[model samples]
Target chain A: MANKHYAMVIDLNTCVGCNACMAACAMENQTPVWKNSWRTYVHDLEIDPGTDHQVRRRFFPRLCNHCDNPPCMSVCPTGATHKLDNGIVLVDDELCMGCRACSMACPYDARFDVSYNDVEQGKEFYGELHHRTRPGVDKCSFCAHRVMKGLKPACVETCVGSARLFGDLNDPDDKVAKLVKTGVAKPLMAHLGTRPNVYYISEIERAR
Target chain B: MEGMFYSTQNVWTWWIAIYLFLGGLGAAAVVVSCLTNMYIKTHKELVLWGNISAFVMLSVGSLFLFVHLLDHLAVIHVLNPFGLLTKPDAWIMWGTQFIVWMMVFSMIYTLPYMLETPFWRDMPLVGTILGWFGWLGKLSLSFHKVVGWLAIINGVGTVLYTGLLLQSFPAVALWHNPGVPLLFIISAFSTAMAFLLLVLHLAIKREEDHDIKVLYERTDVILISIELLIIFVFFHFTTYGLESARHTADILWNDMGWIVGFIGFGLIVPFLIEFRGVTKGWNSATPVVLAAILVLCGGYLLRHYFMYAGSYERPYPAINSIHSQSNYNLLIE
Candidate 1:
């Protein structure tokens, strides 16, 4: 709990939008494709038209913010959605009642309903086995399975452009910490005060 | 519309709307019943009817909500009473605790009267139990008086909790407003009155009092007017509050459910009908019943539209460039 805030930083400058990270995340997490399990996906954004009349589509990767004060966790009736001491918010599938309260509470639209059929179909379609047998809320886990084992998240490890970086933000020696200290990275929707752990190193005013 | 479902976009649907409506109605009914029983001691039969109807309504509403849970098998997780003390922030947890206590207290409050009924008097086991506790009847009556206040408090909590449950969803702009609970409680109280009026008119015609009926009609009219005002404030606040809130307001403004169903039919028409009781007089049970029916229908529509009008803010719209510059300019910064 002391100085152990794990975070992810995405450098939009270097991101090529190849989607290798998205595929890697899906495979590693055994997420379903039917419902568009966009735990990590590259979004194409069209910049506002300038005075010179030019429109450029920028590649923006999106996922759960893993907030310090997650609304989803606060609204959960059964304590099914919780945030770990290491700063990773996760869902307890067995405890979840599938009330969809967390889904509505998430400002990031990060949570998705995991039906029994969805999980079963996911196993067949992706040919990936999952340890979670029950239906509940599903979302990005920040690769907690691997992170706890000292391995980088599949998305961070497989990024072709080296855009994604995972490290302890509380550690000053960490590159993500330096980047954040230098104001090269910032969390999304800061105005809403969720205090997201996922930061994007971009200077775009619109994203702010 | 057939293709439409509540879970389609992760937005709530009909089940939740109906649940909110029923929950509020049931809670308000209980509170009203308890209040009547506490103050109007002479109408024992009427109070008894109210208590029975309130219990039935609350239980049925709770069951419907439970049935609507997605992971129905895991409902025990919510039912575990320990979570009430543990999960203080969870409004749903608070709601569950309130509901359970309300039911328990309501039953205890009604027990003495229930046993006094002819059916229970004839049963040998019930008679024997009554005989055994006959000496303690005075103590039970005092306990009932104290428990009646507790039930009323819980009843209000149950009604308000339903609104707070929805309002706790910070992501949904329409539901996140402070006015939601106010609107819901007002509608709940009005609907409760309508229900009482209907039952008194149809079921207890002999013992029905004219002054109480007139008071309820007047109170209902005022409630409807306040409801309309709060709804307007809700829309106005959201329309100007945030972009996300504006989106929900836009939905409510355009949708027929809000315009025709909730506003025109639910509030205005009913307000006009109930207004007649104040300006003129009710004169007959027909107008009172008709007005009551309209209010009830309107109350349901209010909740249904409230839920349907809720829409999430578009999540993290991808911004490609900013500051009147291209991505190349961003790199320099």
Candidate 2:
């Protein structure tokens, strides 16, 4: 196979705001549940609130963009944040000094600090099988561990509406590649030049 | 409506602010002390005390930086030389190297003066320690000029790194401007003068050091005036440059700390005091000392408020499109 360039596409139309992805991510990643921080979460957005038009609800799920030009990786003093050939960004816990510079540099607000206390709490919250063994800056890894094992991310696998799609963007046959090639899905804040791998498909307006 | 979609960055808190302030102040003091020793007239007391203060301030500041880290034991990772070679553009890596080298060169520069001091030469434990390093001190004195230049270069690097560190964070609109580094560099020098003034008045009250005091006062007056102009430009640029920057400006302007504490008390108060002392030939130590103290406080407030005022850009531009219409508003949870 050609070099894999992983990507994700989230179709806003199909999402039901159930937050299954958030729960699955928290459980699989051993996130700080008590603090309510997650690798991915659905934002409950109110559009045109208090306007003459009917108020509309939008469920916007957010996670690390895994940008081609990752600022977090460049700003990292210890080179703790690194990108794989497949375009997945990962943080080496042993090398991360937890300066939170990566958190500040990320435009997506994806990175979160996992303190020593958070690691200690993970043992109890995750029932002693917690994989988070050290304190460092944490973020969505695109579930690289599972992706390498030929399985989808926890968020995509558990998505109830099947709104989240994950695949190798390099493969022209992949659905993600088709959506992107056809311009049906768009990346957020493209003007920022981060070249985000995560794309979004907007909801189609119903005929009045 | 934009407030709901945009969030203030909370990653860098008062710890980073304190570190930035102390780092700039310490580095500037070292630069000023070295320049004075080399060019004008050498005052042993100023050189000795100034270097000591710089060393102590930087040490305390680095300690705070270490405290800010969640993984303190992993600090060794920062010291790895390969990181610098790999990511040469990373300011944090440069900052770490600058701070460490600055401290090392500063100590070497201070070694000869420390050995010459009667306090160190006569004190029981210190005298013995000096005796052990007698050959080293002779070596340092032999090439003191080279050591001084190296210290000066690293000191300047450390001072610039403090501002460049913030400027590298493009996500925060308030910190991404070139004006930040300019403002920080000027403030660093200004604060250094104020600190030296305090030392001159309180610790080493020598009549022979009148020229030095006058030089510092004159230099500070010019620096403060430039800083005021820069502050004006900073606010103007942020207000008109980008929407996210305007939001950060709104936050900063509304805070009484930035207004009354930094601008009114910190900048204006000290500027008037020092400007008057320099122009009118007023030799009173009382008001000058007061102005110096206020300047120091102001320097710290500058970093603290700027850190707190950093606001991240809206994550998604689609929200902008939806909210731009007159009848639309976005409330993000």
TM-score of the A-chain for all models: 0.92, 0.95
Please write out the lDDT profile of model 2 over residues B1-333, one tens digit for every residue. Answer: 342355565446677888999999999999999899889988778888888899899999999989888899988877776768887878989998888888888888888888988886898987898889888888888999899899999999999999999988777778887999999999999999999999999999999999999999999989988999999998898788777777777778878999899988889999999889988967579999999999999999999989877766653332210112211122122
Candidate 1 docks with a DockQ of 0.45
Indicate the worst ten consecutive residues by lDDT in candidate 1 chain A.
A199-208
DockQ score, prediction 2: 0.44
For all the candidates, what are their Cα RMSDs to the real structure?
A: 6.8, 4.2
After superposing candidate 1 on the true structure, give the runs of residues whose Cα lies further than 4 Å from its correct spot. A49-55, A122-128, A203-208, B1-11, B118-142, B315-333
lDDT of 1 by residue, A32-107 (tens): 6566666777877676567988986667888888999898888898998888999999988888888878777776
- Candidate 2: the clashing residue pairs are none
In candidate 2 chain B, where is summed lDDT lowest over 10 consecutive residues? Answer: B319-328
TM-score of each prediction: 0.87, 0.93
The residue pairs found clashing in candidate 1 are none
Give lDDT: candidate 2, residue B173: 76
Backbone clashes in candidate 1 total 0
Worst 10 residues of 1 chain B by lDDT: B1-10
